[model samples]
Target: MLKHPKNAVMVLARCFSDLDRRLLLLILIPPLSLIVFFSLSSLSPVRSFILGRTILHPQQAVMLNSTDSQQSDVVFAPSSWKDELDRSRIAVCLVGGARRFELTGPSIVEKILLEYPNSDLFLNSPMDSNAFKFSLLNSAPRLAAVRIFRPKPMPESELQLRVLTAHNSPNGIQGLLQYFNLVEGCLTLIQQYQKQNNFTYDWIVRTRVDGYWNAPLDPKFFVPGKYLVPPGTNYGGLNDRLGIGDLNTSTVALSRLSLLPQLDAAGFHQLNSEASFKAQLTTRKVTPVLKRLPFCIVTDRKYDFPPVRFGVPVAAISSPGPLSGVKCRPCKPVCQGPCVGDVMEGLNKGWGWTDWANGTLELCNAHGDFDEGWEKMFDKVAGKKLSSERKRVWKLTVEKCIANFNKMRNRTGIWDTPPVDEICKTGITSGPK
Candidate 1:
């Protein structure tokens, strides 16, 4: 139907006299189709953008269908996946105070650190009486850095004041700044490790010290080009509790303090931590993947029972949870089934919301202190292994705590904390007679 062969080739190439015209013609021509197919097949498949710092195309995202509850349960494990992870370099950056580390630390060691024994652990936490509890990290497979610095007032810049809001933060903007400092400080440690080793890490896991994991972090959550976060508990932005990403994307995620100027330039104002987290990722063109992860934030803070539209829902530790980093505590459940449905339906999905479908969630009436005998409740829910860890911390003496800290310090690549004697004696004292 073409006037000439050149014209036909032009139509396929969208131009004439091009170097690729012959190649295009070969691909388009029916006679060469089989030959072209075989040739291309042998040329190796085009690699995905995931393994590098390139922006991922939307079509490449592997996300659970938001409406399909069962999609979250489907995990495809290639035989070589775990072996591949073992070969890859990973950094696990833990931040925040070890307030309830006695309860949460063991779960973290078992579920995350041991799950991928190759990962190097880095902790950036403020030194306090509870910090001695971090001696529990003696169980970690590999120690990269431990910085238990004493807290000080972080200087708040004009840009930071403009970009961040004190709306929901307990200690206002200063608290947010302190938190940002902790996260960014951990990033500095990771970068320094890579610089000293002359090699970059393949992945970085940034998590809170207070988080408790009910199950192992599955390999499926590691999508190469995208930053992974637990779905829900996003108060006007992304969930900031736990994050997983490749080095490039994680660098942006962990630059919580350094990126405020960029956020200010972008006209983002009065953003909460979660909202700011989402903004930073969007500003850098880093795609965020939301998956239902099996972890929860163990907190002593109480929330109103039968939460309203914008109120927080505190979950009971006994719930069948991939709680997705929602606030939870060891307590007797006060709501389930239809009751949960009623409460969750009334809450705003954009704020203080988490997946409660299919009996996966149970609510706790957290208006009061932790239920009497919560230690026993925690032990029962945490099983034999983690329960032993709890008991160990409960009965820990200054002498034993110092011994554990010294053991951990010996294994650590960088020890930035105070002396083990000071750390242990500052916290542990003789128990009441």
Candidate 2:
């Protein structure tokens, strides 16, 4: 059993080589697995978790403006403005608070990219410094939305009264108060961006986070010298439903709170979206162009139209609907001997609603809960590239958004980046654009 000293050295060398190989494999697998995981997540198709395909067009090309029937799906317009909004022109703006955006965000994106393929999409939401806020919306005409300012939650007494009576809603003035703040923000956007950039919009289309659309907005709706809004579902007056106004008109209309005193001094009372719609026109001398749109309010409130004291549900014909300013889907054409005749009749005549009552309703069933099977349904209607972008962001869970958020918060310059100023030309920097 004599063994040479050199034999022991060889055995030791073999063991060392095996140990090195093991170490290499250990280091390599985790990152490789992570890479695969991230890649797979990116590849998974994006489905609107809340607003499904109900409001989107299955084929994206269908959304391109009729005139520019061959535009690209992704439009990065080099940050410019088109002042005179023509019938052929498209303008898109996102109006939301950047909270719970994941629920109905896709519907807004799909609708804009679809309806106004030739349009430039603008984002004007306020978000927290958290990375999750604007991730769903950074895909299109992205401007750093305003920082959302939510007042401290009021006491239960005030909350109950505010919630119960339309007159007592926060910031009073009923009918989409936050909408006015958002409008004011957008108007600020228009004023600052336009002044610095010397650019204007033909039409400013304002929409919300929870509005799930079932169909595309047809171009025939745009008539000159008129603001277009969805009719019916106007609690007392205009729907605030979705608004599209030219620069001259929108400048004042979107100035919600600021304009209220002007409206009030002009004898505006019992104003809701509907009454305000009339007052904005009758008082301010701006007439609205009523159009039946394909969208439904994705709200958290319950309405008791008739026979049900205060908390009866007004259900949609379809579950996940765009409900595009049309007659609501009746569970049965003639249900229960017209118990909710007022709700049904107001819908039928088309008060201030911009829904699609002519045919089927684009239903959205996110009632304090998201719709089921929405993923598949959304996939059916979403644009390929947009879906891909959403997938990319979600999969990566891009945490850098916090950086973007903070960076925007620290920003003081408002006009530098808008279409008006050339960084090279201006030399003096104003942080916000």
Candidate 3:
């Protein structure tokens, strides 16, 4: 009459099995549980990497993390420039040879002062027998500071040897090293000046002392986020010829040698000046914008105008310029007619060479012997008002320099650990800007 023992046992086991199944679900889905718990525990590391990358490269990462519960408050945006007429606090650092400074210095100074009177001037030229006298630059709109140092040549070192050897001793490689040394020294000088004065620069304008300015340095070319270099002379790449940038940009661009390793790895071994420049810009992801500047390197070397032979002069200062600054002069071209036409035809791509066929500029040559008429012509072109202004500025700069020179006595800001040899001295006396 009592139910079979087996049936009673089976009924009890079924009820237990149902209870166990409910308890298992309450404990959590194993896979999902592991995910939530670990994510919460390791929250800090994941958040940090995401935030760091965001700060470094914000442009690429924006919409990807929208749904994440963690919020990124930082926003990265590109800079915008309205090209206002207001003066820019620019610093022109001239630290190279002085041979052509006299011919070109006045024009450059006058143009900048007239166009952007708010700019400041700084010259870091090391002492050389022929360095441009500061008297020329004295007329700058606002005198910031000038320190003329006797550049200590690159110390003989392994790096110098390696750099000299690296690119098969390519043409202009030595010149490259010389330029690198000059720039690096001046950058050091800039840092020192900033520390001493407790001031920083918004932009640094670098050019040879002898670069003649034929017209206004149009500020419209200053793009917000990219470095600008003159066009035309883009020899195999970016012309390392002249450069302008803010402090943030310059810190990376100034040291040419520091970039050699990367350049070599990128297979950029035999680049000419222009090509080297292009590689440097593109490789480092430094965006470069080409713009026409109303200036050209005052050169003294002479070559055939419509060069047919390798040594023939294909490109010249004259060519009806306003050549969109690729590398032609806007001045009355010395080589008119056939030479201009030939060079124009020979030009390659958006690179080297320019066309003056439209005729808005004139002829001038840095390499040609100076004519007395040329000086008078410049004086006339500059007008009486600018001449007087330049003269006055020159006087003030000379006086300031003399005052500074006397304050520092014989040191004259030229630091020589053991002191400069008397025989090697260029004897730059301060009385000018």
Candidate 4:
């Protein structure tokens, strides 16, 4: 109880010394040292550290702090082009007959339409027995316009005869004219919709109904200035199977028929579909950018099996690919690896050659028709829901088909085609008139 003042002072001094030693130990530890160092640094230096700069030695910290404080302020960068496109108006212009639409349509719905649910769909197809398949679009998210018309023979002008060739086109020059009309016709419909609504679409995706998409359309394909098309199957020109571009470039690319006079004037002769497409872009001064895309044109056309040089190599539907809109069908792959390399070597580089390197392509012996139970094969590859759609279409009754068509017609902003009864009945049993 009778403690001396000197003894109390000595106890206090010893306590202060112990606290200092503990504080030094804490600062010397790696984790706490970092925190202490940052705490002591100026705000600008701390901000630089957080913005991916390495912390300097304590000796250099003061120098960095002084330099960073003198520099301009940092600013955040904007979002990517994909984010811009997600908000922008996009028109998915699907052209061609619904020949294999049952196999292909669901993929379009799942990959493109659902992937970009805000994009409007414009369906321009010539009515055929397979036209009933177009009814599947009732499941699509944004159906904008539908034009299923009777195939009328387009009058082949002298210029068309000169500028276009019947070489590989099954229907000859007339067929080319009809296809051109269909594509350009979709552009016209898009323009009409824009005029009516007082707003223009920022992008247009021109693709075929027969395309079996194995993957979603990558947003990187949506480049602003240049038109994007597939790299191979140039056929002495560019791959015309699919195209993606802005409004201005698409107008030039899609005006397939209207630009015939321009092609004729440019002295382009005997040009096939792809060549004509290339001519159009060249004439219009639109630079085309080629990227390998994930879909292929599902075809019934027979090509030489074990394709020779310059012969078409049909891809197996199951091949892992950005197949770039090449001809494909479901079948057991006949060729792979070295076999693919040898077959691809024979094919003309400017014509049918696709990048088969690193096992990117698998070949189908397409000389025969699609293998039996191809639906099962497709289902296995496309997943449960898409396969179910295929079965539904195959087993579709006339009544249900008509009902689906009605729903699609109701959703469509522009409906131009035969009556629903006729479209539905044509594909199903041909009953008494």
Candidate 5:
């Protein structure tokens, strides 16, 4: 039974030879395959593709650990933010009269409307000569609602009289009430739309029709959990000209008429629009975030020419700004550089004064009506397309105005205004026969 050692070893090797080969293949193949894979992944394009897929696809999110996810969330690129906004539902509530819609409307359409084409527009304005110009909104991507009601004088309640001031308000306390009604009425319209559709908006942008935007509304301004408004022109309160917030915060901000009782109860007396706005937000515990927005309230109201210190310095429409809702119009800039510093130094910081640092402020001689040849100035600044709109409005006929209004009315989800004929003809015909 015992064989020679060499012969015995040879027999054993023959028996195990097939098992050795299989073990060798299994152990070597995996490491070899991994080496090849890493070698290919070392190429720039391949590496980038792998990383990009990992970042872009949430299904692959498991590849990143908790630390990596935290880091990635902290560093958001602009494109990512834009993508988020593109997916979000936004309501752009435009209130106030369409006094200079020719100048401001095109800008709103191009900047806000076109920039976020998915957003819905809610327009609540009073019927006036300028009302016809709102038909420009037909170009909007989504027209949610339109209410261009004729102003029957609102009976000023004793509470409104107690809570508001007439100082600097042209129509006095009644004017403030009317303006408040217009703003709050827009909110009511928005609420109704939400209820009917059975969906809620993610963001609400409340801005004036008279505000002329020079640049698109930035996505960065839409801060979560806090309401955003322009700084300066506080005038014993916050700037009420432009606001952006979520539905909860905007509900607090836009409840102008409903909040009067609360304001009165809180002993807030003789508050201007801005002051009242600040009170409402503060009392309701809404956090306000101020950022310089790239627009100005286009106004025909004249200020002192070559304004002295403490005087309102109307900015030229062409001034480089995030003007923060300062009063502006088309005119040649008369004051700039050191002149701006000197003029602003004399102005009260809490009043209508805006941030004029870094030569951002430019003055206009607003002593009289928009100076002759101002159209040329405005054209140069607003560019050809907007200028053409201005010209169209100037030459708008009774028939065309009616046609445009009718088109907009048909498109609007909610239309509450005078008959298209009455709105068109009242402004078109000159005489009080």
Candidate 6:
């Protein structure tokens, strides 16, 4: 064994070289593996976990990286967009029944109207028991017009009959016509305001009276050339719940009634409201930009649980959601975690589907009216200020309501509603309840 000392030295050198190679491999593998793993996570249909949050989709990854994501749920418009909103004249068109205005109004004022303080608010709603609750908006920064009309039957023309269908509408074709009238009425109000003020609005934000906003409206939605709408709840068409656009695009989008003839000419038929909305826009060459927004339509309507493929899925109001104009109600969540995943997986993505990933959605039973003491649930979720507003409305009296309406009238550019007494008396009595 001691015969060849030089050979032994060469063998020892080879072993040392092999040891160095092994050490280098050890040093490189972990970081390289991490690089590969992260790269793979960026691909589609793959979920990436970062900071304990799941990046469920490619766009979500972009969203997380963008300045749009914030620690607080309240999302602000980019500084540039904020500047644009400040300089630009914005007309906020609010339509729909004031079913739960007491619960929803403060959020709208705080999140949207106040977010863009320069924007003018125009409301076109049918007068109902809840109409008096709209006095909550007296606190709005800018008031343009308010129209609380007694809804009447809209004449369905031949073209409307040809183009629209009554399939899923609870009120049939008449319902659609009334909705179209409400939307167009707001547009008319805006136009009249412009003529009176001698200045045209640069933007219009069309939303519903019953939309409860969980966060501030993102300013990125104000796309100049495109009409921005929420994603999902599209029944064979685009989501028509909320819309934001520049003057030209908004004109086309808001002319829901007047655009029927054009849609008919383009060979679109048997359309529901959402479908008709999509048809009108596409026929007019206005591109719809689908963006997830931080508001939901507050509804008292009940729907099936664990929704079937085409059935509507009712979301819980407390869900950490952008909701994107989906129907939601205040209730105890009946489903969460994997239960939600399983339920949402069964629904049609083109129908009532909404983003439920990363615990963003929770389901409400919605098989009946709001759960007992849902008010407490709402207060907890909405926090103190909004909860106080809700309490104020609950205890509102005719005199106070009238005073609130008068205050709103004083600030408003045009007030086309009935006498303040009539409006207040309809919803509230002589004294606090």
lDDT comparing candidate 1 with the true structure = 0.86
Superposed model 4: Cα runs more than 4 Å off: 1-80, 430-433
lDDT of 4 by residue, 1-433 (tens): 5289998888889999999999988877988778876675555466576765543343233222222123434332123444666798999999998888888999999989998889999999988888888888999999888999998877878888988899978889888888889899999999998998899999999999999999988676776667888878888899888999989999999999888898888889989999999999999999887778899999988988888876788999999887888889988898999999888887777675667889889999988778888778888999999999988887888999999988888888889989999988898775311
Q: Score residue 163 of candidate 5 by CA lDDT.
A: 93
Write model 3 residue lDDT over 1-433, tens digit each, in one string: 3389988888889989988988887776887788976675456446456555333122222222222233555433323121232434566666667654555677777766556676655565656644434445534655555555655445544444443443422334566676676776566666776787788867777666656666776554444446766665554466566677767666556756677677777766555555655676778777765656666665555544444423223223443344444333223446555545555556454445543555543334434454445445545655675456545533443345445334433422333221223212333343322
Tens-digit lDDT track of model 5 for 1-433: 4379988888889879978999999999999999977765555346556556323232122112211113342223456666777788999999988788889999999999899989999999988877778877878888999998878888988998999999878789888989999999999999999999999999999999999999999776777778888888888799999999989999999999999999999999999999999999988999887778899999998889777645667899999987989999999898899998878877776685677889788989899899789889999999999999888877878899888888887877888888888877876674211
Alpha-carbon deviation at 116 in model 4, angstroms: 0.9
Give the TM-score (vs. native) of candidate 4: 0.81
Clashing pairs in 6: none
In candidate 1, stretches whose alpha carbon ends up further than 4 angstroms from where it belongs are: 1-76, 430-433
Q: Summing lDDT over every window of 10 consecutive residues in candidate 1, give the lowest-scoring window.
A: 47-56
Candidate 4: worst-modelled 10 consecutive residues by lDDT: 60-69
After superposing all C-alphas onto the true structure, candidate 4 shows an RMSD in angstroms of 10.2
lDDT, candidate 3, at 63: 28
Instruction: Give the per-residue lDDT digits (tens) of candidate 1, residues 272-340.
Output: 999999999999999988888888999988788888987889999988978989999999898989999
Backbone clashes (count) for model 1:
0
**Per-model C-alpha lDDT, please?**
0.86, 0.48, 0.54, 0.84, 0.84, 0.85
Candidate 4: residue pairs that collide = 309-346
Off by over 4 Å in 5: 1-75, 430-433
Best by TM-score: 1
Cα deviation in Å at residue 215, candidate 5? 0.2
Is candidate 1 or 5 superior in lDDT?
1
